[model samples]
Target: MEKQFSGQNQKKLGLSQFVQAIEASRTLAITTKVTELRRQGKTIIDLGAGEPDFPTPAPVCDAGIQAIRNGKTKYTHNAGILELREKIAAFVNKYGGQYQPEQILVSAGAKQSIFNALLAVCDPDDEVLVISPYWTSYPQQVKMARATPVFLQASERDHYKVTAEQLSKAITPKTKLLMFNSPSNPTGATYTKDELAAIADVVAQHDIYLLSDEIYMQLVYDGLEPVSMAMFPQIRSQLILVNGLSKSHAMTGWRVGYLAAELPIVKAAAKVQSHSTSNITSISQYAAVAAFELAETELQKMRTTFAERRDFVTQRLRSMPGVSLSLPQGAFYVYPNFSQYFGKKYQQKTLNAALDIADFLIDAAGVAVVPGEAFGSNENIRISYANSMENLAIAMDQIEVALKKLQ
Candidate 1:
């Protein structure tokens, strides 16, 4: 048999192990399925999206148009255009942090900025501590960097937030970085200043890097302000603050995000970005400057709308039978524990995991949602409230009815 091997018997090529280790985004997969169903004339209430339901601010859009008209559509500095970087520096400094233009690197989006920073800091076999119920991309990005991702589950009883003691115990000699997201994506848990300071003390003591993803910092509710890790001078040098216009200004498609770190780290990330995606779109960079400089009023209005939606969604979820959830402090998501119905059956199918419930909802209720298993928990499902009040109300009604049918 060995002697008879030929071209037809040769093994097929496959993707790299790094690429193979990570799964395709579950959120995007559900969204695509929902789109297909809608195209077939089905009315699907999609709550799987992570983007704001608002339009980009008028001033930011106008700036992009002006940039294009002025022939500003040329290659920019690999770290982004200078004016944008300067604006980013000033903005970060305003929040009680010290940053310079040279310390800022602008990439395609906050996701890219975080990925680039991970690649720049992580080496083979390095370990990244990721908080559970995290953004779907964090662990994937760590894997893409050829590093190991170690998860530490934040206390669900404490609103899915990691504490300083928990973080301190999780550290090992192999730990290279910690991924922290405030107003977290799936859970919408925000850290207070005291909590951040305590965690920052641990990072400082360990001398490890911290990647603070603050994309949702602007959407905090109840007059709560987000505290930056960079605001803590003791750990300032070890912090990489990643933020962008995607969330705050409803410019998700614009692809303008930046990171503030030490100069050397910024340079390293810039090199990585240069070899990958040289620079962000020129028009988007110009538009981002206007977003930072002139869109506060519009951004505030959007935040207010999101707060109202958050309250509405939380109230409805709490009132539903067999559903349990904590009120989100920020961000646009409500992750409800749906394990109460795990043993229930519908139409000869038994619902066991969060994915099963999600699939059942899509098939029977025509409501699309991302399952909690995608975020490292199988007992819950994530519902994004970044939709119209009317659509959300209707979706809640449909969900309640669909759940009641499971007996």
Candidate 2:
């Protein structure tokens, strides 16, 4: 006979097992800790944020206010306001690909667009090939959608960008999708037209869906143009182009993101979003229209500033001893490999991983950085130059002094 379970002997209630599979974002965790330390009167230089330091363009903000004043705050179409979608379609179609308003789904943010894409297509056991060091949310989103994340390391030797040959070898029968990011989060590596063409060929051959996260598309520096996977018309059916005004317009708080896919994919993703978040904020949708139209000049100014900061930060990090990194082609981050310091010690603490190094820098240098382990690389750490040059210079100096003490 089986023994009866009593209420006291039963397991305590907690988050669902499915939800528990996803871990809290290490980037956000570090940022929050730094914020708390700063509030406590600690002098902390934060370099962990992924957002631009610039403010949202005045015209875009004014559009939102105007919309509110006009009472354009009602519920929008579940797929998004038609006007915004049409503009998004036009903007995307300006490139090599073709898109229609009906094929676009505007969501709360690019983050939600990504989640909806995965949830719409992936089944419980499907596998998503994630290129590391990926944005930290990729794996968690895959898990939350009941899919498995398969990592293919984009090694530092290759400038942290995966090759088509590697992609071909990694694909299995279980692989249903690939999460692709250019001007990538941690390494800032962008793919050229030739590189994208090669990868597109592989993706087409495998018949797998490609989710191209181009949130940082307009942030590329050095006049390097990032090739969109959607440009390959042969594989357009397999492409889900994800983008937002967050990074491009410094509208991180606006929560405006969208995806352009084929009609079937758009409908499926919109269904997922409709059941969950419904339409994005109506005011944000209106603001995004102005963002696309009136913010280009201001956006260019922000880009110029980021380019300057990127150059300054990259040069400074390269000059530091035992630090090595490829010059990022785009995005505002410099991911420096600090593995050379791994067996060193400071006081009683042994630095064996990037996390340990991050902790050391925060405590000793009063600088906050996201550890490379969070991006699936143990040999490197990510530093964002999205702050003012004055703060960045001071942070780098503190990091230099802290690193020296490790020996």
Candidate 3:
């Protein structure tokens, strides 16, 4: 029954409890707040961006332009253009998975690809295992599909990597899927091949599926080899491999991402996508084929630059007194504990959580960062080094000074 408003005959519509209970993405939330702050004539150094600082590769950009000139603006297949799927299949196969174009489903972004996979495999009330300090989207997407999210916390002592023992212990009859991200967001921790294999073995014994999010597969540093969940053939049949060109190819705005999974899962996700978004933009699909074809050249250049910036950020953070963090293996973010300053005062207010520190940084230090509470922890904050080296150096310097003033 709809209730009438207090002095009117009109009745306001209500929202579903599930939707009402959902929290907005804290990463994007901070980005929005930073934009608002900068609009007020305040100098703000934004290190909270989630995408690469580099531009999309030249070949990929040319491909998109060509597609537009060739009048390829109309919609294509619901699953995406055949040529793009073939390239995605070949790309995933190159990374250790045996895939065919029939199993690939292209979507708007890696975000949608993951959500499609979740909606395809999950039933109402099913539980999804989300390792903590996870991407802010995981649990929200799980809930959007009516699945309960079961969070397993990874300790900083382990470099935030979960072990096979923990994976085995977390599974239950109610668990329908495991959302695994390596070169994970927020923490930037990547698992080794042997470590992934052990966890894959545990999943192999269960009836659940593993949705490996390898969005950051191309960003590892410090002489580490990239490992995909698809590398382990034992779990291949049950693996739902998710990856895209956004991070590796710097095509965040192009909106091209795909999942290589079993045919049934692909078909199911395609059906869900069909009613919702239909095919992704035609020009973007054309460019994605180019991105896959031009593999390592442009990406290597960006990766090298990011590696240098990572080194600088790591060294600066380590020298700060009372600060501690795992050496991030890949991706562009650093999750560092700032709990030592929790009881310190800024103005007349005490810093009680990561949110407070984030607030203090933006207001006092002119820097923007996402609080750890956004990633399921309150003792740390995530600083994305996806900015210019000069900006990063200044941000770090200001962060250090602002932190020292907590007393």
- In Å, residue 36's CA in model 1 sits off its true spot by 1.0
lDDT by residue (1-67, candidate 2, tens digit) is 8766543334554445666567899999998999899999999988999998888888899999999
For model 3, how does the per-residue alpha-carbon lDDT over 19-68 read when each residue is reduced to its tens digit? 67799988889889998998898899998889988888888899999999
Model 1 stretches with alpha carbons more than 4 Å out: 1-12
Q: Cα lDDT of all candidates, in order? A: 0.90, 0.91, 0.91
Candidate 1 residue pairs in backbone clash: none
What are the RMSD figures for all models against the true structure? 2.8, 3.0, 2.4
TM-score of each: 0.96, 0.96, 0.97
Estimate the lDDT of model 3: 0.91
Cα RMSD, model 1? 2.8
lDDT, model 1: 0.90
Distance from true position, residue 74, model 2, in Å? 1.2
